[model samples]
Target: MSSLSEIITSSLQKYNDRPAIWVDDCVYTYGDLSYYINQIRNVLHQQLTSPALKGERICIWAYRSIDAYVGILSGVLSGMPYVPLNPRFPDERNLSIINRVRPKAIIVDKNCEDAASKILPTIKFPLLVFFPSYTQKPKWCSLIKQHQFFSQEELISYPLASISNLEVGSVVNTDSSDMLYILFTSGSTGEPKGVVVSHGNVFSYVNGINTISDCHYDDRYLQHIDLTFDLSAHDMYCSWCSGASLYVTPHNLILFPNRFISEYKINKCMLVPSTAGVIQGHNLLFPNSMPSLKYTFFCGEPLTGSVVNGWQKSAPSSIIYNVYGPTEATIAFTYYKCTGDSVDRCLPIGKPLINQQVIITSSSETAADEIGEILLGGSQVALGYWENEKMTDEKFYSHSGKRWYKTGDLGKLDPNSQDIIFLGRSDRQIKVRGFRVELGEIESVIRKIAKTYFVAVLGDSDSEYENVLGGEGYLNVVALVANSQESKENIIEECKKILPDYMVPSQVIFLKEFPRNSNDKIDYKEITKIYYKNKNSSSISAHNNVI
Candidate 1:
């Protein structure tokens, strides 16, 4: 029932000297966390409220520094939503979010100041740039004349004050409807859609996870996902709620998650199965390599039996669970704990969390089989797409007196086990390297760039280039364009400027004509077969073209 900020403050009071988070070589104690949070809170409250600026939320455009972590908390405590902007994302993509969110103040780390500079002029109103990690003003300060800037030293000199008006408890806002964060995911057309998650939604979701009964102060949790992704919430709250220490894996060690898990002796670890697939591709999933782990959870992508078995053996002492959920339903609301013996290629998603509900939309009550589009319901369901009434109304609807989100994923209930089994997306949406992406989004970009409507982008495993290209054993985004005059090289080159790295197509195949179905629509399955057949006959090494 408590907000994360309140839980964190309680931990600060109780476990003052205990390590709260390990960022690279630095271990930030709860005491250190308190000091930093105070400095940020003081500056934030002073600059935004004192000046009487009209702003909705705080935008955190930061790298994985201690400052970023403290900034997010300070914003939450102040009853303002925090929108995270990743430095890895393209300038165009990040700029779009900046233009849309129009946050009151932006918290930035030293590493992200340059990216911040590019978007400063875009802010239409008065804004504050709180540089917690910078001792001196950044070089880009002079370029942006409208906004006020504060260095780390400047904020430290401010008086100590509480943002929530509570000494050490999380009261985000008097209104339960106040938002905690707004996460943007891939859109069906082209742009990314913001998913507004309220403080109540996050708090309720965290409370629902209490039945797991494994997280504790002594256990060390490893953060393997990016802050931009919702999965990061699980890594943060699950540990903080239990007074457990969270170890933030450095970017250099992110790709080598298995090694990071082993080196740090991470007891509880959660990651996308794609990460495990990468580790397995490098032949690093050796038996007993991670015996210190007590739990291993995978989400964001389908968890295959091979990855499940490989991880179980690697972390012999750990219990592995395959988690499934769209970002709209908090981090995840359903999970299937793995048994050592699993023959199914793709593991079942299992059952709902303590407070969550899952239903097969297309199945009737008296049906012989329970199989259809899976819908998720409970406190975990997100508010809706931010300011997107049309989409919200379309996807979120009242069912049996409770709000439920249309997952778009097809699933079936296992009659014997009564667990939900994933049967892939009913639509063209797919996860590429742990990133939820829309095929039409990529196609839309290509259509606009190439000036043609005959563009089809899909994630295919048998792209006939896996053996040739150094793929990390996951679905690759491939584009099939029909007789477009624009060169494949040029179209993808332009797409890189607008789309994020993950959304960009890795390979482009030009077709003489797209095979049409009965309705003359682009035959996706036929086009894929044609692509594989063409690639097989050519025997061309796709290394030069694979992005």
Candidate 2:
């Protein structure tokens, strides 16, 4: 068993001159990466003297560039847990995260200096900030220089200090059970929670995937997901461990899917369902556009059958895989191969990966025969939420030497095929006229009938219903969002083909785009708020008519 540090060191030795990471036209070979990491390590050693600083929290605010990768690896090599902030994040959001983590230092790219400076004025913590630039020193750079806040050029040009050499120990010390990284959840609902993943947790999950997938040295992987998101974990570590070339597609190119894939010769890629929806909505195909792609992985949100059908039609030869997992369980715990027939049916999340065990537990915490919460027990389970003891105790529990994490998702074991069928969220289940309903079920049915890019179902509160039993009754409300401008009557008529009368949404709202979080997942809470706000202003009534 080797640590992450050992894996990187060995890869550099084996593929010294090989292209290790490609960002735009700038290529960083193994040798170049090794030297840069070493330089960064030396700078860290000079700045941090306290023991806590050895693995203290470090924040990085930068775009997808070579410096971003180097900054991350430098923190790992220096034994510090690092957090990455998307450069596009608003200043307030960025500051909120910074205050929560209270990092010892921050690494900023030159392009983001303006935002960084705005934050620095209000921040009291002593920060060591480094920026990458090729031009002459700017005014802010001179100001910081005068104040001795430290600059990148000074660190890079300074003589290397001679100190006791720190062996490239595991990037994470397994014995310590310490956190290796803190990835914050996309705050779509409210405040984002920081998930603390241990070194052992990451190792077990990555190792399992590496063995099953046979990810090898000859493979060239295209990294499309944001580093802030979990899907990038599979792309980063799997490629790093296998000594494969990692080509990072620029943010601009990612929007133009066909050209991005063809130009990079992307053989393997992972994307969110929203991205797949975009491709399908545009009526794009691979052979005519992105012929180089051989395999693609889709997850993050539910992949509709319609989306899968379009993908298969476009690249029939490409292996389409659907992976599912929460951040609490490393990157992914289950994967399914999507075939033609499988796409027509509800896409099963498939079985658990090697060494991971999953079971459907009822509300009473007893093993159930059918629908229940998805409970996972395996080496891949993370340590717990960071600085959140109450949540840690609730989510993580030990039973007979094994620990299980409650996934908070509803799923059922199929009686015939014995596969797991994902139902909607248990907490999201609502009661309409004493009938239980899952919003996901209604949303899934609506997707098949409409040529929509996205859809979300929420309980409505506008329609009034009279109680026949007691001369008074409570009214049930329902609302939905469709990514098209089709008439409300047309949509309700189409929805009738798949959904039952009670399950069909009472009102349909059309939007050109759905509000999304940083991870590209829909902001359901926000959508519901908007839905109710509109319902309060309109005099909508529920009648026997479809409209």
Candidate 3:
């Protein structure tokens, strides 16, 4: 059996009667969860005739409910890899994914029939849509007469005793290097890429976290991340493996985090930087709230200096950690505890996690203090991007008998503390005239001077440049999005004092809020789309000449 299933099965034996899941007002014990999982496993076995179904991929479409958790566990016990599709995805994208993965079957909630029916015509495989007895039936289900759908009561009536008799091994064997899940990344440029994570990779990460955080069976995890994102894996598997209780918050209560955390009694939680920013923004609302919150981790985007300061001020007693990793690295490979001193500047992403190694590599060999691309070599690195060998080969490479995933992020090692200080992305570094410029650096300076809520620096590539350069035609552009009333004049004045002529932003556009992607990160592609659309229509031109 794979380590994942073994861990869960062992936990169930120890904590059989303990409350395993709490969603809304419903509570499910470990015994109940185990029974439901076995029942669903029996249903899958009865429905499929092929002996090779053990390794086949299955797709699950459901909301954040106890039934969804049972469905995931059933997939694991039945030796099948599972993929979770968010209910919020549009019909076109959902259909595209179904066509791409070609899963043998799809398990969906009956409440989503209206949205599901829009994409049902595109799905060619068999399906088992589920309807819980607790919720009201959707009106659209009455129209679908051809497809097979099951209700909670009817499904439970099937003999689960037969399922208990069948021998079920783990979905992931030790030697089998197959993908356990395919999480689709938010596609800003075009179609999203499916990040394939193997069982070994996930196990390595979970084990590391367990050791570092001292996670135990008594830990009560508050799940805030969506199941589609990799961060959710920490809450799902970590809690399940340790025999801990998991509380899934309703989607509506997510934005108003104070209420969600208080009502759910969330002791431990993970959040994106954007959500953290909002929570910290309203610090006065919950001055004494988060007493039960023992561990809080933030990722999914860079945590700015201002945001960190706010969190520290609000949740003074909680242990705040800043974790860094891409989706390709199984959520996080390195983490930094936000000490009182780390807030003075940008917090350093501390040393690598267990079984992980990070190296700063430049064009030429250099000392430890040199700045370069942060290359990650570890057990947590994913297999590769699914089905795109050319793009996969470019990013994933072998070095020194170890496979390294080249993180496009730039960083420099601190000489005194030996921690990694994050710089901006290498691709984001632009050359204006003859001077090299880092947009993040400029944004940092502007943030300090303007004291804005958020800031984003965008390069305008299509600007006209005729006589700005000395006989050379260099385009003039600008930075956009700063949040403050004094931002326009304050940013210009600050830049003139500290920055050279070429480094100063040619234009600064203030806005109420910046556009963000589904993952809660800044949507640069959408910003570019808006920039071009507005540039063509506007007549007022502001260009800084660099000699």
Residue range 1-547, candidate 3, lDDT tens digits: 3477677777766788998888767888888887777666666677764345666667777778776787777766566777787666555556767777777656666445566767765455666555544243355556666455666665677665453344333232333255667877633223556777877787888888876786877777888777777888888888988889898878787666656666666777887665655455444335546566677787655555556656555556668777877777888888887753443345677778888988888623357777899989978888887777776798898878767898787888887787787775666544333223456666666777777746666554333322111111123436665456665766786666655454567777765567789999877777666666666666323212110
Each prediction's Cα lDDT score?
Answer: 0.78, 0.66, 0.66
- Tally clashes: model 2: 3
Write the residue-wise lDDT of candidate 2 on 1-547 in tens digits.
4566567667766887887888867878877777766666666666785344665887878767776777777776666777887665556657877888888767777657778877766777766666544333346645543223445566568567564443333232333355667887632223556888766677777777764565767666778777777777777777777777788878887646556667777666777655655555555644345555567777665555666666666656567777777888888887777874443434677778888888888633343346888988888888888788888898888776667899887888766566677775656654333233456666665565566647787754323311111111112435455555567677777655444355567767665567788889888886776665555666323211112
Sum up the clashes in candidate 3.
0
Q: Pick out the ten consecutive residues of candidate 3 with the lowest summed lDDT.
A: 465-474
Residue 488 accuracy (lDDT) in model 2: 68
On the 0 to 100 scale, the lDDT of residue 5 in model 2 is: 56
Instruction: Give lDDT for model 1.
Output: 0.78
For 178-249, candidate 1 gives per-residue lDDT tens digits of 777898999987889999887767777667666664767888999878889999988887887777888898
| TM-score for all models, in order of appearance | 0.93, 0.75, 0.75
Name the best candidate (by lDDT): 1
Candidate numbers sorted by TM-score from highest down: 1, 2, 3
lDDT of 3 at 439: 61
